[model samples]
Target: MSGRDYDHRRQMGGELIIPALAVCFTLYYFTTIWNSPWTAQVSAFSIGGILLLLCAAFFIKTALLLRSSEASLGLGGLVGIEDVRNGRLALVLATIGYVWLIEDLGFTLTTFLFIAISITALGHGKNVGRATATAAVMSLAGWAVFIWAFDTRFPRGWFETTMQGLMANG
Candidate 1:
């Protein structure tokens, strides 16, 4: 009945959200691949099962922490940290934009721009040159591995289409 006890319970409840989400996702994944071949579903099944167990362990630990009155349950400290909130929001928005633009710009170009901008944004707008160079190298390496080494097809946007056309004509 003490205020301290109430606070501890609330914090434990807040910490439970992540484990709850993991459990939900694991169940969803299991159901989706339930009918697939064992070879195709093995990785998903293994990873999902491991994730579910980890979540269960987390839930138990948090519950025990609350029972022992070692921590408060309020979520404000975690979710209300202003600097982290802004950075996380920006990153999420950038990721959304990257996904939206990928079809039009193609994977290589879109990923390059996304990585550069994400690095700069996450770094609080410092070190633009390094971010750009790193992004370029990563994007090119990914393109080479996927397109050349693996011989997988990615969507072709304007630049890819133009290059293909030029090669055909020549």
Candidate 2:
């Protein structure tokens, strides 16, 4: 076969990160909801069960793809260009930080920050102002829809509490 065909073949390495993370998160989700109400448990298990099946399917696909002689296990597939690697890493950090801080910061504020940071990172700082504006609008809309309209069980922080108070009084 040609070198071009060889290069076009399979690759792995950090490709496993996403599936591994999905499995871990699904498992954690299952573990946390054990004491939850039956309805909640049923919903969580249904979704997590799908996630596990998907991960299993992905792993099987990866295994089959790796069976090729041209398969590569290099880390190059993690991020294509070296320049954007930092940006991707920043985005990853932003996601981790978002998950870690969402409970304390409230849904609106945390979503705003996460979206802003993500946009800025992906845009390479070329659109920070626009990112901030978009983040604000999106976050407020999320609050209006999820917290105000639907009144879902999202974690409440300063913004949520203050907004609830304003709406109650006014």
Which structure among the candidates has the greatest lDDT? 2
TM-score, prediction 2: 0.59
Q: How well is each residue in 77-170 modelled by candidate 1, as lDDT tens digits?
A: 5666574646776788889999899899987888899999989888888999999999999988987788646757886567556655776799
* Count of clashes in candidate 2: 0
lDDT of 2 by residue, 20-124 (tens): 999999998888988989988987898889989999998887787777565666565556776475588788889999999999999999999999999998888
lDDT of 2: 0.87
User: Ten-residue segment with the worst summed lDDT in candidate 1?
Assistant: 76-85
Q: TM per model?
A: 0.57, 0.59
Clash pairs for candidate 1:
8-72, 10-73, 11-73, 11-74, 12-73
Query: Each prediction's Cα lDDT score?
Result: 0.79, 0.87
Worst 10 residues of 2 by lDDT: 69-78
Q: In model 2, which regions exceed 4 Å deviation?
A: 1-72, 79-86
